[model samples]
Target chain A: MEKENIRYSELERLCKEFRKTILKIITEAGSGHPGGSLSVVEILTTLYYLHLNHNPKNPFDDKRDRVVLSKGHSCPALYVILAELGYFDKQELHNLRKVNSILQGHPARVYNGGDEVKFVPGIEVSTGSLGYGLSVAVGMALGFKMDNKQNLVFAICSDGEHQEGSIWEAIMFAGFKQLDNLIEIVDYNKLQQESRIDDSVSLEPLKEKYISFNWQVYEVDGHKISELDTALADAKKYKGKPKVIIAHTVKGKGVSFMENNVDWHGKAPSKELLEQALKELEGK
Target chain B: MVTVLEYKPSREGLGEALLEIADQYPQLVAIGADTANSTSLGKFAKKYPERFVNVGIAEQNAVGIAVGLSLVGKLPVVSTYAMFLAGRCWEEIRQSVCYNYSNVKLVGTHAGLTVGPDGASHQILEDIALMRVLPNMSVIVPSDANEAKVAVKKSLEKVGAVYIRLSREKLPVFTSPEEDFVIGKAKLLREGSDCGIISCGVMVYESLVAAEILEKQGINCRVINMHTVKPIDTEAIINTAKKCKCIVTCEEHQVYGGLGSAVAEVVIKNYPVPQRFVGIKDKFGESGPAEGLMLKYGLKAQHIVETVKEVIKYK
Candidate 1:
C-alpha cells in the first residue's frame, strides 16, 4: 500500500461526491437514511482515502485494517464507498434495499445468485441492531493483538446508540483489556430517530465518561478532513488505552433543508429535494 | 441394564474436554462472563491464561466478541448461565454468530430447573427453544457427564454456531466412554415394544428409570436419548413412532418449546402418533431442593412413567 499524503482540497471534493452518491441511491431506493449517511461522509472519506490500509481488489487480505459501520442505517454511504473501491459493481448502487441486492438495508456479506455462495468480501460483519459493532471491533482488535499483527479495527457508532447498556459494556471491556489498536468514532450529530439526543437522553460530559472508562478521547469537527486526519493520526500513535474520536457533525450535511432535521433520519429525499441536493453538491 | 457411574456436573465435563483438546486446536479460545468457576471454565483459564477471556458479567459482549474472534480464524467457546446467555444475548447471538455462520460455540450451563436452590431466577427452561429457532444454529443437550464431554469436543470440531445446554447439578453418567457421540444423531438407550420415551439432558436418566418401572408392569417402553434438539433425528423419531405406535417426550424444561415441542413437530409432520409430554407446565419454579423441584415440576421418573402409561393406552 502506498502512503498517500493528506490533501484537504481532494478530500473536500470527494466528500461532496460521496454525499451526491448517497442521495442518488437513497432516493432511488425510495426509503433510506439520508441524515446520518450525509453526516458520516467526510469521516468515512478521510478513513478510506487517507487512513485505512486496505486493498480494493483483495478485500480479504489478512493484514488489512477493518472498518465496521456500527450505525448500519447509514449504509448508503458505506455502500457507495465500497462500490467506488471496486468491491462490487458500481451499478449495483441503484439496487439498494431491493430483494437479492448485495446492498441490503444493513451491511451484510453479499451472496452470489445461484449457489448462494458469499462472494462480496469487503463487509466485515452484519450490523443493524445498535450497540453490537463496538464489541465486535474489540474482539477483532484483540484477535489481531494475539496474532501479533499490526492491523487496526475502527468502528463508527451513533450518538443515540450510546443509550444502549451494551455499548457501555463494550466500552468498559475495551478499556480494562487495554486494546490500543481499536478506534471508535462517534458520529455525534446530536439527533436521534425521535428527537435530539439531549432532549431524549442526554450524553452531556460524554468525553468525561470515556475518560472514566480509560479511553483516550478527542473531539473533532466531523466535516473537516484535516482535523479528522490529525486526530486519527494521533490516535494511531497512542499506546496502552483505546482511543475514541467524538466527531461533531450536522445530521444532514451538505444539504440545505435537511440539516439538523430529525425527520430525515430515515426518510429518503423527495424527487424535488433530490434534485436540489444534487445541485447543491454539484455546485460545491 | 443401566450402569451408574460416579456423578459429575456437565459443566465440569465441558471444562475437561476443552483442556483435553487445547493442544490439538491451538486457535481455540475460551470466553466467560465472570462465571468461570461456576461454569467449570476455571480449569481452562488456569491452564491457558492467555487463551481465556473474562468479559466481566457481560453476556452480550461475550457473544459479540466471540463472533469477532471467530472471524479471524479462532474458535471461541463462550460460557455463561443458560438464562443470561440464551435470553440476554439472544439477538447478539442471532446477528453476529448465527447470521454470519461464525464458528462460535456457546456453552450455556445451569440449564433447566435443576439449578436447585438458586431457584427460578437462575434456572433457564427456554434455552432449547431460543437456540433451535435460529437458522444456522445447532442445539445440543447432553444426557450426562460423559455425553457433555463428547458434545464439547464435537462442537469444537464443527464449523458453525452451536449451543450446548449443560446442567449445574451433578448427573449420573449413563453413557459409556466407548459410545459414539455425533451431532444431530439420537442414541437409543433401551429396547421395548409398548411405547417410546424420548428425552434429553438430565431427563434421560429419569426416562431410563421410568423404562425399568414400566418393564416390571409388563409395559415395555423404549428409552431414547434425543440429545441433539435442532436438526433433530427425524428418522429415529419416525421409526420409533412406527414401532411403538405411541410416544412420550420428557425434558427438564418447559413443555411449550423444549424437547417435547421439538419431538411433536417431527412426529406431526412425518408420522403422527398419540403423544404425551412429561415436563414443566407453563409456570415458573420456586426455590426448593433439586429433587423436590423435579418432583413438583413433573420432571421425575414417576411423571415419565405415568405419561408412558397414558400414551400407551392410545396404542
Candidate 2:
C-alpha cells in the first residue's frame, strides 16, 4: 500500500519549524547544546516525517521501527519532533530540564520516582553518555534480524562522539555481524563541545573507517532533504552490511551567527538572540 | 558430614542453565565478549546459534548491545571476564542498562582472585561495589555450581538488570540441586551461637569449612550463604548478628565493597555488633595458583576461622 510520497518542499518546511521549536525549548530551558541540535534538525525531520515506520499513538508498538538518539545532547530536536507528532502534549516541551520534569537534561527512561518515563513515545533507549546509543541500536538490529522481523533500527550520532572508543567497538560489532537492518546517521557538523572536532580529535578518513569495517558508507548534504531521503532508501535496500550516512553539515545550520561557531555548541540563546533567530527563521 | 559433589566452574553452570531454559524461554539470548569458551557459553552458542551473539572482545559494546536486545523484548545474557565487563563497561551498564531498567543479565565470570595466575589485571574485586551502587541493579554471587545455575535461571525469569558473578576455577559443589534458590533470601547453612560467619560466592563453602573447624575449638559458628549481594538478606544478617553477638563476613572479593560491606551495612544500621571481615584487605592479587592465591589473599577457610575468633573476642 503505497502512501502519498512526502514532497521535498514539505520536508524543508518541517525542518524550518523543527529548528524554530528546538531553539524555543533550548532557549526556554536557559541551557542546551544548540549547535548540534540545530545541525540535526533536517535529518530528524526527514526520519520522523518520512522514513521512520512509527505511530505516535502506539509508540511502544512491537512492530514499530526504533530510533536511538545517541547524541542525546541534541535531544531538543527529538523532543520537538515527538511533540509535533502527538507522542505527547506540546505543552510538556516547556518543562524541559526542569526539576521533576520527564524531559530530563539527558535522555532517560525513568524519572526520580522509578516510574517508566515516557516523556515522548518515540524516544527509544535512554542515551546521553557518548558511544552508547549505536551499540544499543546494533543490539536491536540483531534482535530484529534474529526474530526475522522486517522492522529497522536507526541511530543518530554526533561526529564528536566518534572519539569514544565504545562507538568504534559498536561499529566493529555491527560490521562483523552484518546487521543490514541497522542505519547510523552521523551529524558531521565538524564541531564538538568547546571546540571543533578536528581540534579536539580528528575523524578524518571517517568514511574510509566505516568502509574498512565492512559498512556501506554514504555521504550526503545533510541539509538537503532529497539527499537524506535517497541515502536512507539506499541504506534500507542494501543487504549483507550495516549502513552509515556521513551527512556533511554546518554546526548550527540555518542560524547565521551560530553556524560553524563552537561557542554555540552548548550555550542557549538569550531572549534578544532568540527573537533574532525566530525572525531569521520566519524570514520577517 | 556434608557430602560434596564433583567440582565444576560456576561459569559452566551458567552455560548449562541457559541451554536448559532455551525451550522454556524462547526469548533468552546469550552474548559473549570473545570469552564464550572461557565463560562456558560455547555450548549455548552451538545449541542456539541464532540466539547466541559473540560481540568479540568489546565489553562495552556487549553490555550496550544487551540493553538494545532487552529493549526489543529479548532477554539478553551478556558475559565476559569480570574485570572487563564490570570495570571497562561500568558506564555502559549504568547509563544503558540500569538507567533504562533494561532486562539484561550480566554474568561476570572469573571474578575475584580465583582468576589466579592471570594476576590482578584479570581479577575484579570491586564489581559488587560497582554494580550495587546503581539503581535497579540486582547483584548475585552464587555459592557454587548448583547455585550459579539456579541464579542464571532466576535472573532470566526476573525482569530488569542483574549482575551474576561467577568464578573460573572448579569449586566444590556445596549446594544441592533441590535447594530453594530465592533472589534476596540468604540460606543459613549452619546454626550456632558463638559467632556468625556470613559469606557468598566460593567463600560460602569456605565459611562452612570454617564452621566445622571452629566447632572443635569450642567456638560454635553459624554459617549463612548470602548469595544475593544487593537487596541483601538484611533479616538474616541482623538476626545472625543479634544471636551470635558477633559477626564475621567472608568473601572472595575485597573487604571494601563486597559481601563484607553489604553485611556490615545491614548490621550496623539494624543491630550494631562487633564484626571482622575476611577478604582482600586493599591488596591486589598476584600471579599464582588459585589455591595459593586464595591463601595469600586471605580468602581461605582459615582466614574465616581467624576472623571468627577475633570478632568473638569483641563480643
Candidate 3:
C-alpha cells in the first residue's frame, strides 16, 4: 500500500493540534462527543498522516483507502483531519453541527438539501447508528476484492458499538469470506453514553471473540501514535483474513480533568473548560 | 377484462430480472440474508456466483453491506423476507441506504398475508409504511410477475434507493412484458367512469376481477396498477378522482399506511374525492393457506366490489 512519509514527531504534533481543533469546534457547536473524539485522535492521525493511501485532491479515486467512522459521534476528529489534509476548507470546521453545515453531528456522505447542507467530501458513508459502519466496511472490502483491487478499508469502531448484534453478523461475513483488505480499529475506551461498557453490556474476551470468527486480532495502546502506526502497517501485510486492532484508549484522553471521564462522552466543553483544555493541550 | 397470461411468484420475476439485467449492469451485485431460494435469488446466485453474496440470516448486515457495495460503484440488490428486511433492519435501511442516497435496490419478498402459513411474525404488512416514510427512498410494489420483472430492470437503470415489494405465492400475470415500468407511474388496466379502483401488488389482479364484476352490473370501474407506492402517480390519481364518482384503494398491506393511505393522502389533498380502503384492517395476519388468507382477510375481488359500491353511495 502507498503511504505518506510523515515522521513520528510530526504525527505527535498533529495529534495535539487535532485535539485542540476538535475541542474548539465542539465548544463552538454547543453539543458534541468530546470523549470518544479525544480518544481516537491518535488512531485517526496515524492513519491519515502516515498509513492511508488517500488524496484530498482526488477524494473519489478508485484506489484510495476507504475509512468509515463507525463510532460516528466522534466525527470531530475525522472532520479536523480531512480539513487539514485539504479535502475541504478548514473554515467549514467552525460550523460543526450548525444548521446548513456539511459537518454533521454524525458522519454523513450525502446531505439532503432540505437543511441547506450538501454532501461532505471524503466521508465514506453515512453512519451514526452503531454497528452499521463495520458492515459497510465489509461490503467495501468485498467489493475491492471482487474487482481485484488492492485498496484497503479501515473501519474505526467503538467498544460500546460491539454490543449491537449486527456487528457480529458483519464480523462473521468478513471472516467467512476472508476479507484481508479490511482492518478495524476499535477505540476501546470502555465507556458508553450513560455508563461504563463493562457495567452496561460487557464485551469481555473481545480478542478471543474476533479470533473465533477467523480475524487476525491485535491489542495496542490507542493513544500512542507509534503503536497505532506499527499495528496498521503490520495488519496490512498479513493476508487471507481480516484484521482488528483493539486500541485501548482513555475517553477524553489529552485533557487532565476529562481523561477516562464518562461525563465528557457526549457533552461539549464549556467556555471555561475550553480555555483550560486548550491550555493543557498546548502545555503538553 | 385484461388477458391473464400465466401464474408466477413475483419473487421469481425479480430473480429472473436480475439474471436478465446482469449483462447490462456489470457493477450489479445481489446480497441475500439466507433467503436466497425463498426470495428467488438462488437462480442469480447459481449463474453469477461471483457477484452474488449470501450474508446468512442477518438482514441488518445484508442492508449495511449493500450500502457499502453501492458506495464503491456497485449497484447492490438486497433481498429477504419483508418482515425481516423492512421490519427488522429498518434503521440500517434508513441510515445506510436512504440517508446516504446509496444506489441500492431493496427487494422485500413475501409481503403481507400472501406469505400465508408463516403467520403474523413472518408476514409483513407494514413494509410499505416503513419504507415510504424514509427520505430518499422509493417504494415499489409490483402487481404481478411480469411487472415485478420490469420493476427490477428499471430500478437498475435508475439511480438512488428503491424498495421493491414481492409476494411468495403465484399470481396471474395480467400486464405485458412490453409495457414500460416507469417509477411513480400507474398503469391503467381497465378503464371505467363510475368508480376508479387503485391497487398494487397481488391485489391488482383482484381489482381487475372486481372491475369486471362491476362492469356487468352497469358500474364502470377503472382499474390501475399502482406499482410505485412512493413518488406515487399523483397525476393519474387526480385524473381518476376527477373522472370517477368515487375511488377505492386496494392492497395486500395494512389499510393504515400502505396503498390506501398513499392514495388518500393524494385524493384528500389534490381532489378531495370520496374514497374507501380495501385492505387488511388493524390486525395481525394468522396462519392459513394463501387463498384462505386472502378470503379470510377480506382481500378478494368481492370485497373490493363492495367497497366501491359503498364509496359510490357517499359520492
Chain A TM value for model 2:
0.95
Candidate 2 chain A, run of 10 with poorest lDDT: A112-121
Q: Per-candidate DockQ versus the true complex?
A: 0.76, 0.85, 0.84
Model 1, A169-277: lDDT tens per residue? 9999999999999999999999999899999889989999999999999999999888899999999999999999999999999898899999999999888999998
Two-way DockQ contest, 1 vs 3, winner: 3
Q: Whose DockQ is greatest here?
A: 2
| Residue-level lDDT tens digits of model 1 in B222-293 | 788999998899988998999999999998888899889999998999889999998888888888878899
Query: How big is the RMSD of model 1?
Result: 1.8
Candidate 1: which stretches are off by over 4 Å? A1-6, A110-115
Angstrom error of the Cα, residue B315, model 2: value is 2.0
lDDT of 2 by residue, A43-105 (tens): 998888779999899988999999999999999988888898998889989989987677878
Worst 10 residues of 3 chain B by lDDT: B1-10
What's the TM-score of chain B for every model shown? Answer: 0.99, 0.98, 0.98
My TM-score estimates for the predictions, one after another, are 0.98, 0.97, 0.97
Task: List candidate 2 stretches off by more than 4 Å.
Answer: A1-6, A112-120
Q: Which candidate wins on lDDT?
A: 3
- Better-scoring candidate (DockQ), 1 or 2: 2
* Model 1 chain A lowest lDDT segment of ten: A1-10
